[model samples]
Structure formats: structure tokens, C-alpha cells
Target: MENLHNDIYPAIDPSVTKSLHQPGKVVLITGAGRGLGRSIAEQYAYACVASIIICARTSTELDEVEASINKINSAVKVTKFQLDVTSETAVKQCFEAVKEKEGRLDVLVNNAGASLEWVSIDESEPGKWWNVMEVNLKGPYLLLQAFLPLLVETARSNNTVVDVVNISSIAALLTFPQSSAYQLSKAALLRLTEFVDVEYKDKGVNAVGLHPGGVVTKLSENNDAIRPYLIDTPALCGGFTVWLTKGARTWLGGRYAAVTWNVDKLLSMEEEIVKGDKLKVKLVV
Candidate 1:
């Protein structure tokens, strides 16, 4: 066994700040209009990513996020697309545009999701419950299906690693009354991450599921029933995502991680975690 204390729990160094720089990379982020998605885009901009394509259902929100990113780094090529992730045709068009304009995509962030009514299973409206699934699980499925070929192609041609970062939630692991629909959707999303990684790992494409923590965003504000639990900042997930994409982090591929985990500590435990195949969804025998 590894000495976790000496190896993993080192003191934080206040003087060191981590940043990722991918000057020619192109990233596409769904739900990039606000909150966690917006923060993630901003971090990528700061990292000097060459091109960023942001898509969401609202044009106004997308425009605002684009402007914010440009202000951080005017050199970054920012493209805004108003998209409905639930619509396969719309997702296809978005990726087509990315391929036409950018030629290749380095990262795809499936951040768009919905958590409609927070009622118990029995009380939940059938249409609303299913809508959550449509956005949370089905949307990513559509995007991943549409984008995998392009990601794999880019990786093979350039000999570089590509990524799919699914913004999952801790709700996937924990159960709470009145939120079964959201919980089930996220749990399925985590499984999707594993499935994609397993299928595409050999092709230089990596997929990861991440719990963005309890960022107080419009998604949570709209659901006053769960506002008290929202405590983390969007920047936490945003910065962590840039870190995840900086290197292949092959050891962490197909796994689910929490933004609350310290990056340095997690890196320290990489060997042990990978050896044991930890931090992934498992059947509790």
C-alpha cells in the first residue's frame, strides 16, 4: 500500500498557480452561455486556446459569454452558436460548422443539462421527468455520436490526444428524495463516459465524467428547493477542467472525479488510484 499522507496530502503552495496553454487547440463547449460553462470557457481563453466554439439555446446569453471571453484574450477566436442540445439536427449542424471552420476539435465539453421539477418519482410529471433524461443523457449521446469521428480523426492525424469532458454531478452517486429524475440522468451520464472511454481509448480519444461541485448557477437558482446545497464556485470546475485537458491524464480516463478534490493531491495518488481502478462507477457487491 502507498503512504497516502506523505505521498498525497502535501500542503498547498500559495505561490504556485496552475495554467494550461494550448495555443492552436479548438474546443467546443455546450451550455457555454453562463455559470459553470461560462467559467470553463474563460479559463480556456486564459490558457490561450486558439479557437473556442460556445453553443447553447439562448443567443443573448451566448453573446454575453463570447464578449467576456474576448475581453480576457482578444486573440482567441470565439464563435457563438445558439443550439438546442436535445435536437440531433441542431447538434449535427453545430459540429459540421466546427469541422468546416476549425478543421479539428481538440476537446468537447458536454455541459448542457436540465433538472426540471424536483418532485418525488411518484409525484413527478411524466413529461418533465423524461425531459430531464432527454437533455442530460440523450443530448450528450447525440453530441458524442456526432463528434467522435471528428475527434478520433483529429487525434490520429496529429498524434495528439482529444477529450470529452462530461459535466456530471455528485447527485449521480447520492440519493435524495424528490430528485430521482436528475439523479438517474447523471448516473447514466457517468456510465456513458465509461462507455466512450472504453470504446475510444485506443484511438487517442479520452472521455471523463466530472462532478462540477455545487456551483450556484441559474440551474440551481431556478430550483429553490435545492439552493441551500449550492456552495462551490464555477471557477473551481472551470480551472479543474483546463487541468484535465492539459495532458492526456490517461490514468483518469473513464473515471468520475469531483471538483472539490485537490488537483495536486489527486495527481499524487494517480498511481495508486489507477492500480486499484478507483474513482469509477462500480457494482457494490
Candidate 2:
């Protein structure tokens, strides 16, 4: 709840902006080519992350991210890996490359996602659902399978913890009658994160699911249902991401961190606000 316009979204020259100054910690982000992915990469780079692996199907997009990150922090390492998460071989190779280059990974952000025209269960093509599942669910599954060893390796080497943040959606927690495939795919991912969290806590890898709310991105351009509520920005999402990483064990982990007010209220343990109870709140950046 920080001052959005002042502390968080103050206008500044991109040229003068610098990295976050967090050297020696590596972070791997999927779909780092555009939208939220690109923003998250920039934010992390600004934070001075030791190394950032920008993974995507487009070498050009990855290259753009790398250039942007390096421009902000030349000392930060930025590596690009072309990958199609739907392909198992590609996923394996990407992680192997990370291991070879970074030696250790401190964070993994599963932000790659896919969408299609709205379709109901009765009329939706099986292929459409399969495609959604493959990219949204199976992609993360493949990534976790391939890169989990490296996460563990990092933790064992540092004798600390690492994080895996799954980019889920409000649709995943709600009933989307039109886009059933997208909803189901994200819902499955939520369950997947839970499973990983429980299964790997002792291994030192913590996993959590997040919903960035409606944002003005390609994913929302054509989806009218979700477009209007899309008031959040990529930078805001990026900020929340870093915050979550810092407070993973205390404020997050094994829980859904959503931008939706209703979701937050529903999940809150505080008593319901009854007709203007003068609620106290804190500003967040």
C-alpha cells in the first residue's frame, strides 16, 4: 500500500536509472521478452542481481532484455536462452545452460503463459485446451523437473533458500465460464505450486503462486472480459514480485498473493469491516 505515484511510480529518466545493486544472486525468468516478464527482468537487474537468464522462444526479445539490463547495470550478468517451454528438450537445455553459466540460481520466475479465443467446454477445441495446458501448466512442470536440481544445488552450496514463483491468474481461483481452458490451466498450476511447496520444503526450494491482476498487456488486449479491471502495471507487478521474494517465508509461500481486493479480503484473518470501521492501512511501493 505504498504511495503509488510518489514512492513507486515516480517519473524518472530510464538512462539515469540503475540496477537494484544485488550482486552475486542469479535469477532466471521465463518469457522475459515482453510485458510482465520484461519488466520483472528490468527490475531485478536494477536490483543488481548477479546474473539474470532471460528465457523465451524469440532470440530477438531475449536480446532486447539483455541489452536493457546491461545498459542499466553493466556489472550484472545477462544471458539469453531461446526456449520453448512446451518442448522438454528445450527446457532441459535451458536449465543446463543456466547451471553452466551462473553456477547457482537464487530465484526462478515461471512467468510464461498462453491464451486463446474464449471457448466453452462444449465448443472448445481439444487442441486449444491442450495448447493452453502445455504452455501454462506443462511448461512450468517441465521447468521444475529440469531446474529443480540446480535450485537444490544452489541452496546446498550456499546453505540457504531459493524461490520459485509461479505466475498464476485470478481466473485460476475464480470460475471463468468463457475461457475455461485458461482458467483450468492456471488452476492446475496453483495446485502444482502447492504440491511443490509441500514436497520440497526440506530441500530448500520454496514455491508460491501469484496473480498480477488485470494489466494492459497483449494478454489483455483482446480479452474484453479482463481488460477493464486491468488497472495494474508491469512495474507494479515487478515491485510486488521483488517484495514477495524478500518476504516469501513471512508474508507469502504456500499461499496465493493476488492483486484482487476481494481475494485479499477473503484470505485475510482480520474481522470484516462493518460500515466504516476506520480501517488502518499502510502505504506500499
Candidate 3:
């Protein structure tokens, strides 16, 4: 099999021309303190997004990301919130805070995730499996439930589409050894993405799942099971995310995409992708 991580994709360079400009659009990214999440936030800052709400469990990390984004563009409003996405109450309060401050939310990136144990099914404990599910799957569900009202209202009032980008993984599609928990969670996440798109597309809310490639992040670097694979830069996912937000790509809702795939190449095949029902999760009969 071809190595999925071997492919090179475009990176988001601050010096290059910005392709996504959401001048007054407000975006909220969970787990945005570092790694791919931080890269995503920085990409948005360069695109001149009006307000960016970054949330994570650590205040110090959040502070650093906020400061970094501010240094890049002083005008880009950065709000750092210490949040544990696994908590329903915290998710509710965070959304309420964003509602009070921004009046609306234009984009939501459910990027918080964890892989507790990489052991095979026989060796995996229930507690460890549940931990992965709670963070990767349930966290996004709670976030969507809490933020949907604001997203719907914003899309209706503004005559624009709201976006929900779930940071999923290629593990959801391929069967890899000793990755039961992480793979299950990601698979369910893709289903949740599809359900959100089907239920809310008519209301102007679009949702999609993104496989961020095998990026060398703290998560992957620490996991001995996956550290040896060829990895892509976090900027690949960051740039692809910005491209996903553009209105022209609304048809991509309900689909799953990989950052390893070139954005321009993906866009060029948009019509065929939609018509063929490609890039969507389906059970192979």
C-alpha cells in the first residue's frame, strides 16, 4: 500500500497571498493551544479573521498562542478560554461566552482529541477506551449541541453559511493494529459529521470531517506506535482548513478529506466528487 503520509501538500506561508479572508467572521477552535490547532489558529490570523476564540485545558499554553496571534496581527481579536471539552457544562459556558461576546459564531473547529492507550483490543481496558471516546466523539457532540443555535441564527441573519470542521483521522478508514480506541472514536466522528450536514444543510450549516494527515505533533511524537511513519507538516492541515471554509466549497459538507491531498486538485474535482458521492464514509458491502 502507498504511504498516505508520503505525499507533500501546500503549506500556509504568512508571506504568501492569503486565499481565505473572513474579515469579520468569528471562529472558535478547541485544543487550539499548540500543534495542529495552533497552526490552524495562526492560519486564520493571517487570513484576517475578526475574532478567534481559542480554548484548551492549559491557561499558559493558551496565553502563548493568543500572544503569538496578536503579534502577527494586532487587529485580530484573540480570546483564550481554558476549557475541557469532555465536560458538558464547560462546553455550554464556553459557547454562551462566545455568544455574549461575538453575538454569532461563523466557524467551529472541534480539534480537541486524545488517544489514551494504543494497545490492541485484547489488551485494552474499558477505562482507556472510554476516555478516547469521550474526548474525540462525545466532546464534539456536546460542542455541536451547545453551539448549533448560534450557528443557525448567524447563518440565517447574515445570509451566509456556517461551518463545523471536525478534525478526524485516516485511522477511521483503514484498519491499523493496536489502534482500536482511537480508530473507533474517529470513525464515529465522521458519522457525526455526516449526520450534522444532512440535518442542517438546509438551514445553512455545513459540517465536514478532515483527516489532518500523519503530522508530527506532540501526540504522535509521544506515541511510540506511530512515531516512525512519514509525517506532513501541520501547515498542510491549517491551509486545507482555510480552503475548506470558502463558500465555493460548500458542496464538500458531509465528506471526509485528507490534508495530504492538494487543495487545488481537490477543488478541480469538486463536481465529480459530489456527483459520485466520493470522499464520504460508507460501509463496503
TM-score of each: 0.92, 0.84, 0.94
lDDT of 3: 0.86
Residue-by-residue lDDT tens digits, candidate 1, 225-266:
667868777877777788788878888899998877877778
| TM-score of predicted structure 3 | 0.94
Flag regions of model 2 displaced more than 4 Å. 1-21, 247-251, 259-285
Candidate 3 C-alpha lDDT tens digits along 1-285: 232333334333432655567689899999898988998998888879899999999999999999989887889999988999999999999988999999999999999989865787888898878999999999999999999999999999999999999999988997888888899899999999999999998989989999987878777777876777636777777777877886636789899998777666677798999999998888678
RMSD of 3: 2.4
Best by TM-score: 3
What is the lDDT, from 0 to 100, of the residue 259 in candidate 2?
A: 38
Model 2 scores a TM of 0.84
| Model 1 misplacement above 4 A | 1-19, 222-225
Which is better, 1 or 2, measured by lDDT?
1
Error in Å for residue 101 of model 2: 1.7
Q: How high is the CA lDDT of each candidate model?
A: 0.86, 0.75, 0.86
Clashes of 1: 0
Model 2 agreement with the true structure over 129-167: per-residue lDDT tens digits = 789999999999999998888898887888877889899
